[model samples]
Target: MNFYKNNEMVPMTRRYPDLKDKVKKRDNKISIQLIRAWDVERDAEKVLKIFLQNIDKLSSYRYWELLRSVWIICGTVENAQFFSSLMKSNKPNRHYFSTPEEHEFLRSLPDQMDVYRACNSPQDGGISWTLDYDYACKYAKDFQKNMVLNNKINKSEVFAYINRNNESEILIL
Candidate 1:
């Protein structure tokens, strides 16, 4: 029994070793261009175009980063609508927008402005699994309040969290 249990745990642990640690470290870094686009231009279309062009190249984690960046710039309501329309037009495979959690977060935002504020705030808790609606809303509100009191957005630290390793470099193209 001990041998079987140990073996079972090994594969699970090996599958994603130090993933959480990597994410925690990466969260603080943002690309200067990304910050400039959001802060200076504030052009949702330009940002969305970059995201759309490079959508296929993104890893799941990068996808969330793009979404969060969009939320930060466009805010929850507009970004949600933009994504909904994009999804309708593109019809990409399952890998692109795989999670129902993402869809729910977008669709339900109009009624949850406070949660949107929390989710977008740079100082708030970074993206986590929001599988449950009520929990997500409550968590976002708490995160927003905490961020409001303790932290402020820092633009220079922000790095574009996209995967440039892939052939499709959106900004370049």
Candidate 2:
């Protein structure tokens, strides 16, 4: 589900302003897959860099799906073993955050939303929110000042959002 599909389209005069302001409808359920963009030739850091560089290709619905999945994965009361399992590598041949660079990348995933944007401004701008990661940008401006994260607020007015965490948040993703 791409975000631009259902988004209110501008007139032919506008020529589609920016990809970030567009959004499509969301489904009750979402599917997510964790991708490790690395192989033996490329270390985890290199993989992560490429992955981050490609963040702007995702759509708004895909972004929502990704964030919701990240919320489910990171924001929970699961036990230590569960957390440990989370730490465990999803791969049989590689390690989770095996390299120091990989560890830093994972640690900074949430805050690096800006960096991701700066790194990948081309190839469209949807990927920033689509790929699975932390630090969601519910709004296009959350990376900047005037951030608005709660997409489902106030009859589509997102000044205030009721996030999946059930917490009332302000205008920042």
Candidate 3:
């Protein structure tokens, strides 16, 4: 698993010094347990791997959580790239969203609309964005970032609409 440091991808152990030995020894199960204690820093790539490797072994809720965490914890561009690859062989299950409200929010979007994203700098190839401009601005404020990018896109380009906390986050291909 990798973590971003100064905008560069680095080994997860580098971000979590305690996991260094466990990761080096390939003790992922134990490492995972320890990592979870850190909460949001929860070894996301490893969780995704576990979900893919043991899909049938996990409970439906666990499956849903793991699937969602890819975008939640991983870099937005990385999450987009990963899902883009998956779309060739499989589409994300609607169950991965896990709430009728989330489905309803997606259904409510217009066919063509504006999307916004906040970042320290403008970037290309990002898929994760918000339908709410204020939501994007809030994210920018949280990080003290300056840029807010806006674009008009068709719903046909969207891979998913994730509105878990009313953030109106959308993923596009």
lDDT of each: 0.38, 0.29, 0.59
How do the predictions measure up, each by TM-score? Answer: 0.30, 0.20, 0.61
Instruction: lDDT winner between 1 and 3, please give it.
Output: 3
lDDT of 1: 0.38
Candidate 3: the clashing residue pairs are none
Clashing pairs in 1: 29-159, 30-158, 30-159, 31-158, 31-159, 31-160
lDDT of 2 at 94: 25
Clashes of each: 6, 9, 0
* Error in Å for residue 124 of model 3: 3.5
lDDT-sorted candidate list, best first: 3, 1, 2
Per-residue error (Å), model 2, residue 13: 34
Name every residue pair that clashes in candidate 2: 55-127, 55-128, 56-126, 56-127, 56-128, 57-127, 58-126, 58-127, 147-171
Task: Point out where model 3 deviates above 4 Å.
Answer: 1-41, 55-65, 91-95
Residues 16-112 of candidate 1 have per-residue lDDT tens digits of 2234655534432333345566668877667666666665545445555455455444544334555444434433232332234333334443432
Q: In model 2, how many backbone clashes occur?
A: 9
